[model samples]
Target: METTTATGGVDEPGWDVDPDDEIASVVEALGHQQKRWREAAGLGVAEFATAMGYGEDQVRKVERGARIPRPEYLDRADEVLGANGFISAMKEQMAKARYPKKVRELAKLEERAVELSLYSNHNIHGLLQTEEFAWALLSTWRPALSKSELERAVAARVARQSVFERSPAPELSFVQEEVTLRRPIGDTMVLRRQLERLLEVGQLSNVELQVMPTLRGNHPGTAGLIEVLKFGDGTAIGRSEGAFASRPVSSPRQLRVLELRYGIIRAQALPPGESLAFIEQVLGET
Candidate 1:
């Protein structure tokens, strides 16, 4: 196997996967190791299944990387194969792989951003969402997530907030529709906590938060969400949910149009100070 490349880069299976690529290599490694260890123990698939008290098909599927084994499964395999904690420790690495691929890509982009602007119509922006708020929103979405999936998503969303703590803090701005504040996603307490979080984040010198009143009739942002991220290297990416699926665009012409639309939306929305007051009033009513 190719272990290392000429560029001093790792050539291993797990070292070179793109963010959008399938992350099966690590699981595959675990499976291959399990099979070798089982053979060393002189146990056939059927004998291992009997010892582990699981079906032979289940054991075979796990060994072939066709299924993600549960923690208990790994624990039992470790004990039966006499591999100490090696097999069980793979569980921790697998947890990092549980997050959806798209989310992982988005998180990486957000991490490197020096400036970010967001406009949300249907819900609060993800960066500002509290843990409970994110849990309620994601857990209740259509085609509900499995328990592990929901946990992974909530953790990933909350982890994005680490951007706020970056050295030489990034410039961040958010424009949320007034209706989003009115609709309670996770009951009144959750709504209140979310509003409080907005207040806290809005107080940061590098952050700005505004609200577009519902009574404004219609506007450029009415169609959907918009996001723009700028990097220190003089490159930027913009995406819009209204016109198309959220795909990054770097063309200057396209970016100019998006910037113009976003600027107008910000102008029409309530000023940052007034937006905070409005949020406070809504919180009081709740």
Candidate 2:
């Protein structure tokens, strides 16, 4: 039999709640409520843990707001403490709290974008990556992340895919370096699936996917990645690795520079139809 952690799932650990997170107060309040309900029922920590089928330490962490309780844990606690549906109702908020801060911020920006222009030289853009591909790529980070951290990061990346499902979808344009397609981040099958995903996304009416061949020779994108997001309010934000210290810029002058670079990069890349064919060929080779 496999040993399970206090989080209840096999080999899965509870997420450590970040005290500085924006949702920290909400989680703390929920934890306090859980504790109050248990005490009102005249249950001690050990007794409560036994009732909920979790370890005492884990239960203590949840009550102290140091660990984020999983949905099942919340449901069990609600049933055991007779809180009715109150404890379980916090699951949706807790789910959002589990994602990293940066992911949440970026997702909000993507949600507001009416048009997105992007150029990625090192790897496939996050929006175009498959779940397995994202996992394999993130796993290569130095000073390796813990299992809980890795799973959370992958979840955050995959969650951004919701942008593709939005009604009146945003116009998405992407230019990827030739090498990104050839590099197998996970395994043969992983790369194949990722390539297939690119083909499918490329076919979307609102999306245009292009590839910059390795021999394309000294382009504006050679310096690094570029991104520009335009909104309906006649405002835009942009950033380029080679300019503005790579920080986001919103002034028209700065935005214009990034747009120009991105425009040239797109023009130099393979056309959408040819790019899809190229990706399909790469998939076959895989």
The best candidate by lDDT is 2
lDDT against true structure, model 2: 0.86
lDDT of each: 0.80, 0.86
Which digits, one per residue and each the tens of the lDDT, describe model 2 over residues 1-286? Answer: 1246665633222577789987778778888999999999999998888777777777888888888767778888899998989999998677767778877777778889999999999999999999999999999999998777887888778877878998889999999999999997999999999998999999999999999999998789988999899998989888888999999999999998999999999999999999999888888888
- Per-candidate TM equals 0.70, 0.85
Across 1-286, the per-residue lDDT of candidate 1 in tens digits comes to 1234443332222221233347666666777889999999999998887787776766676677655565667788899999999998987555545446778678778878999999999989999999999999997887998665676678668867889999989999999999989887998899999999999998999999999999986689876789999989999889997654666788888788778879999999999999999999988988
Tell me the deviation in Å of residue 93 in model 1. 8.0
User: Which residue pairs overlap in candidate 2's backbone?
Assistant: none
Please give the lDDT score for candidate 1: 0.80
In candidate 1, list every pair of residues with a backbone clash. none
Give stretches of model 2 more than 4 Å off: 1-3, 6-13, 36-53, 70-92
